[model samples]
Target chain A: MNQDSLAYLPASKLARLLASGELTSVELSRSVLERAEHLNAQVNAFLGWDGEDLMAQAEASDKRRKADKALGFFDGIPVALKNNIAVKGSLLTCGSRMLENFVSPYDATVVERMKAAGMLVWGRLNMDEFAMGSSTETSYFGSTANPWDLTRTPGGSSGGSAAALAAGMSPITLGSDTGGSIRQPAAFCGIYGLKPTYGRVSRYGLVAFASSLDQIGPFGHCVEDVARMMEVLCGVDPKDSSSYPAPVSPFHAELELALTGGRPMVLGLPVEYFKEDGLDPAVRRAMDEVVAYYKGIGWQIKDVSLPNSHLAVPTYYVIATAEASSNLARFDGIRYTHRSESASDAVDVYFKSRGEGFGEEVKRRIILGTFVLSSGYHDAYYLKAQLVRTLIRNDFSKAFGEVDLVLTPTTPSPAFVRGERITDPLQMYLNDIYTICPNLTGLPAISVPCGFASQNLPVGFQLIAPHFEEVRLLTAARAYEKGNDWHTRHPAL
Target chain B: MEHIDIGYTAKLARLELSKDEQELYSAQLGRILEYFHVLSSVDTSGVEPTAHANPLHNVLREDVAVPGFGAGPALANAPQQREDQVLVPRVIE
Candidate 1:
């Protein structure tokens, strides 16, 4: 009931124990707070910690528990929000100088939902600047090390959230995935991360990166906990115009259904994913183990090709950066957090304020976006990427016709040493090679622990489902998790 | 095919790169752009460019007026603020 070993207790059990009087929410909160404080410095996963407020909430939850009130499923649960996610009055820096001190006036739709569910919002975690890089190293705040190995990175832009969950800094952490941000980091850090189908969760209050590609999701050590967090966060929001209006299903309802009673379904292996420098030898072994386990459970496996998947990375960069440039323009000193003191004129201020405020990665992408969208270059760079995007989408639509789910190695390798890929951007880009295509096509994808590499770091197998198919994605993940103890394994802080 | 100047690209990329930073990204981006230029080689003449991965449609909401901009803390942290809005340096062109 103490749940000290974040490695041991599932969230559902914690909820049950706290409800049945075996434990109090305050005690659980303090245990996590103590663990977080002990391990946070090693990983640098959190940017802020509201320890006192969290305890206050826990005490309130305790009061409710003692009074025999109907405690919500996630009541008194301590969770962290990615720095890019707005938490009212919390520094919502999107890992950039642009909003270094920006505070949100209100909660994001996901935050509001979690708040309504009685979950405690603990603090904000680190991320890549404007969610740009494949590793958290791009963060203006500096990088988050993989809790599994301090020398290596927790693959990012959601690296902080993933690492926080891995180190037990929080029970779960919310992350936004734009082209593998969540899952890749989840893979690297040895935790569970999901990118729900585009439009599945409300984007309102999420600091925009690419309005089209970004979807908020959750990271946890286990599949069902991730699903529970997903159920609470996924929904329609009138404020988020781009969110789907479809009724949000109870992620748990179908979750148990998928594990216990769901039919044995086809799992597709895309040939392209395994063709070239596809996966490290050990990771390939991990994939084999995952597939064999699924086959052992009578699930049919097949090979399906997403022919245009090869174009996915380029397509994603152009579309995501183009949207990023537009969405981030609001951060100009005229409107938000920081402005320049040196510029004497309006034009000078426009250039200098942004120049001073944005980090190199943010500037690089903005300029890349500006060039791609400029009149003479528009049709060439931006339009070409968009065309390739169509092909990527078409390929997925075609492949989905053949199978219910597709599996691939999440990252080509386990967490690489921090600063290892700093000099080589393309190599870092390739880190997301297998994961980006899903975001390009608005598919729901989840990364669950498969096995550990030689360095004792974790490797992940990514399962992607057709859009709006969170149920199927979570089902396969839960299925794989139950038969394998990979999901049970946690990083030694 | 158009070639991007190293100087222009560096300026466009807004990097005051140390000689190494400039040289590194230049080589890296050049290779990527060259490979990506294959998109130019593809026949997309009649194909419509897709901006979104999902099907494109409007996500418009009712334009009813709602009160917003709770400026209490927003103004508190401002380097400067006036009348519940952010204050900025002079901007007349």
Candidate 2:
């Protein structure tokens, strides 16, 4: 197969080829790396990669297969990591100038798990600096362009992972979703992204953004690939205290069953999500089509109300930023790589280094976070937001009691122009309007490519399942994916 | 619900903002706080604060002194380091 065809083959197909000896992991890795190199200039999807290390891993995987000791089903597949995830001996920049040269001394648990599964973990994908912004533009490394339209953003902060998959640079990638980081970008790039229940996947190696909200997940060209990734990436990790102590599901097997004999499930459409004033007409039409398609497929569709839905954005910003202010306090220039040279005293060093090291958006968030968490203001802002958060979660809990899944538009619109909302942080924050509640409630949410909008950019149909129900979530997503070809569409790079 | 003192907040946060940033943030943060005023209308008088989404209690692990990254690896990324110690700007003297 030529480079494009080989690079764009779904993970399941590539796994079959590897198992059948029809293709070798080394060849696949080389083809993917070459494609990434060619497209990186235009798409800016990757920050750095070690081609030699990847080839070595690929060769080892091939040897293991030859010896009849293959690690698992994902053996030899080339997967990318978001910049924030720690991969031992690789640069863990988190797309910030603060630690641009920092190399991780130990692998994140997910990286260790992926390595043990024989997957050739290759490259650090770009993201918003410290995973702070909705657009990848906040990255000190630079913004990643949408593959569909270079002038537009590949929604972030996991823009690189989604853009890489959309550009066929890699078949699969992992990203962390605090608030729509994975799903929004996946929607923009027209791929499948899942933010598993908060503790479903280990956050041991993920740089903490909002500790309670952050969960690492996968981006794939298809639902089967995502499910296959979850099979490897999910489960309890002793290193993470918040990790769920539950058995990992046989997601691939479940997906197969879901593809064929799964019973139709009830889907809830929150009327509040559609009533937002700025929602694009094209997105509305695509959602309508998705509802119609599910109805035609014998699934029950019902109108559900997340009455407190309008409060999600405000509550998320308050809580996420408050946690961010606390979580980011470790970058005090005493331990990291971006200490200021002009400091005369310890206090001066702290202020100057943070001010210099952080980007504009990061600084803005730190200030906002600081304000909400400061004395006196804490009760009114932070405490109130937390109480409101419970209300939002309660809304989801009530809806799930009646419906098996909740559906909404992944983003209010398709990828906006790169510089469009950069100046208006509120407008940019609204990009996660429909997505943040799932994180707040700790539900498993997946974004699947539904159809194209008027501008021909991809639109996403989001499905949120109750916590730790990834099997049901992926199964439902698979059911939708099998009947549609939207996931098969790739951006013309 | 008045405008926040961005300078004081930045100081508390250990960040130094420029005049432009301070002025801009002062206005922007004022507007965002105004937006947050909507939360007051919700009757959360009896509601409990959710610190985390999942119900988590004290997660106890066996107290074992597992070997962690020693000083060598731990301080590898330090911007400034002396003999086996991170070199910070002198606060005394």
Candidate 3:
């Protein structure tokens, strides 16, 4: 096996090589580190990388294998994590200055699981400050550029994870999707990203964004790699009370079965989604190709109506910000966050520290949240948004009654240039128009690279399944991915 | 679009804002809230609110004392600490 290409190999193929003694964990770790060293200057995907720590974990994995006590198929693989997900002793920055110097004192539940399985915790990937932006540009550290096109954004707040995996810095990485964070970036970087059903994965140590909508999911070069990640990552955790009390789907097994031949599924196309004004011609073309492919494969495609789909963006922003205002109240200056040296009193610490710590977008959302949840406006904005949220969730439940899955374009368009939409917050928020409903409805959705658009940028189509139906979701994704070469095509970086 | 008092809202949220920030955010928030006005048109009469996404239950555990992270780890990231306590600006004048 050529060591130079080891970092880019699929996790499944890498596992087979490790089992066959064709590759050592140390060799693979070194290769990944070397690739990051070469590409990180351009991609800016990582917030922090510790070569010594990574090698230590890799050495342990190798020693375990040598002693015939290997943990499992993924024992030695390096999986990067979005910085918001805590790893003890690592900086849990969330790409914000508030926690820039704060080190996690304990592992997140997901990190604990990865360590238990002997998978090396690779490093912290960059993200929008506190997972609040559609593009990675909001990150305090710096924006992560698309490996596909250096001038454009790798979609965000999980842009770093997507970019890192797309650049072959890690075989796979995990990201939290509050709205379109994971899927949008995955779409932009031309990889696969899965936003698991809400509560399907624990969020114990994931720094809270919008608690109800935040879900940690995987990004990978192929559908199988993401399924492999789900196999290890999914499960109930007592630490995260919201984690579902459900059996972990044998994702890889189910995906393999689906690929060979799963029952034909009824895929729904939301008429509202297709009819939206901003639907890029290129994105629509990609979705058309996906619909045609699925139809060719004998799957049923039907036009469905999500009458309340137009309200998704408004409802999501209202609810997300209200929750964010409450959730972010924990970041007072006294604790493990940036304290304002200019403060003269306790109250000043709260106000000035936050003012200093948070970026423009975060502060904007916090104020928006505060306004909606304020005493007089609570019923008018916050409660009204929640009531509409029910309508949005009901839209999905109603549609699922007619179809096995819902398919749509993951993003409104291909990756926009770095500064294109940053100045216009509404335009940036609109980017999540198609992606937000799943977060609101608590459904599982995956973004699969459908084809490239103009400028050679990647376009992704999303497949959403009913709550906790990741098996069906991944199976459908595999069905589309089996003969498609989009996921295999890498950026020239 | 409803009028937003940026000064009052920021105070309620306990976030200090610069004069320039207040101006920029006010205009932006006005536009965003105007966009949010669309939700008002949806006649969601008598519809129940969906606060938690998934079906949730109160996770009850035996009322027993359990070992928690000690002061050392808890204070490890504190911006300022003294004798295992996080130090902050004086609360009482």
Models, CA RMSD each: 2.4, 1.1, 1.1
> What C-alpha lDDT do the candidate models reach, one value each?
0.80, 0.91, 0.91
Q: Tell me, by lDDT, which candidate is best.
A: 3
Q: Which tens-of-lDDT digit does each residue in A217-290 have in candidate 3? A: 99988888899899888999988889988889678998788767768999999998988789899999988889
Considering lDDT, where higher is better, how would the candidates rank from best to worst? 3, 2, 1
Q: Could you tell me every candidate's TM-score relative to the true structure?
A: 0.94, 0.99, 0.99
Residue B28's lDDT within candidate 3 is 92
Q: Write the per-residue lDDT of candidate 2 for residues A1-493, one digit (tens) a residue.
A: 6678887789988999999999999889989989988999999989999999999999999999999999999899999999999998999999999888889998999999999999999899999999988879999998999999999999999999999989999989999999999999999989999999988888998999999999999999888899889989988888998998877878879767765776789999998998889899999999999999989889999999999999999999999999999999998888866888898799999998898888888888889899899988899889999999999999998999999999999999999999899999888998899899989999999999999987679999899998888888888888888789998877777
Model with the higher lDDT, candidate 1 or 2: 2
Q: B1-93 in candidate 1: lDDT tens per residue?
A: 344454564454433344654565456666666666766666666667676655538877677999876677557667677888877666664
The docking category that best describes candidate 1 is acceptable
Candidate 1, A188-242: lDDT as tens digits: 8878899988888888888889888899999887777887888788877888767
Q: Which regions of candidate 3 are displaced past 4 Å?
A: A1-3
lDDT of 3: 0.91
